[model samples]
Target: TRATDSPSPDVSPDPSPSEDGDNSEGAVPEGYLGSWSGSIDNASGHSTRELVIRQGEVGEAVLTLTAEGPLATGGTYRCVFEASLTAEPAEGEAVRIGPSTVTEGEPMASCTPGSPTTLTLLPDGSLSRENTSSGEKLTYTKSG
Candidate 1:
């Protein structure tokens, strides 16, 4: 599956301002607006993934993920994942990413869409993601 720009079903809606009104429109935390890359080690094997976070119009964001590596079915593969940032995060809280859907997957790749994932911006300039249902945890470092 080649990477595609199509929107995913789990793409999050525009974020709404907090009741306290702390966040202004289009004011994405600087830390979350960049490219991140990491590797995944799961039951199937090892693979690499990249995530890019982009700010959209006021109070909106777009997130895209790309994973590539050997497939379980015995071939190389690649897939693109997408999700939207739904809610505004309070100061020092993890950015809430809506459920992720596979935008594209290589011919032999077995892609399974998962529940909403959270990207925690660490103090050390790193990020971590934990899938609530799959229990797959991936740690990423800022790349660009």
Candidate 2:
């Protein structure tokens, strides 16, 4: 979740893959699929995030974050957000998703339910997850 102050990112449904070829309008480009994980350990606290993406009506994705320590208000918190990939991204462009839904683990009066995120595939194959709302970012690697 994120703060409500930041501007919202555009949200749109991903298009179905065209039968003609693999380069469909909404097809998730290679390297954007599968599961990825990242973590943050700093003065604020420690958080671990996981993202799982798979083909669906649109490119489907679920993001989960589990955190503890001061950042989490000294308590553990887990949040899950789901959304479809907005569109087919060009090579090297970030893949954006959300205006997400909080399916679970929202603490009382905490955790914004609808925040957008952008995922950039890094040179080392790590996925960088950035909150469009708060500018918070994390780096994730492919997970088994």
lDDT of each: 0.77, 0.67
Q: Model 1: clashing residue pairs?
A: 1-105, 1-106, 26-58, 26-59
Q: What is the TM-score of each candidate against the true structure?
A: 0.73, 0.65
Error of 2 at 117 (Å): 1.9
| Model 2 spans with C-alpha error above 4 angstroms | 1-18, 21-26, 42-44, 57-73, 106-109
lDDT of 2 by residue, 1-144 (tens): 979887566444555565354554345666777888777787767667677766543455534443322444565666776776776666768877867766666463454466778888888888888889889888889995
Specify the poorest-scoring 10-residue window by lDDT in model 2.
62-71
lDDT of 1 at 28: 52
Point out where model 1 deviates above 4 Å: 1-27, 42-45, 57-61
User: How well is each residue in 46-113 modelled by candidate 1, as lDDT tens digits?
Assistant: 89999898874333437888988777668778888788777777788877777878889886246666
Clashes of 2: 0
Window of ten residues with lowest summed lDDT in model 1: 19-28
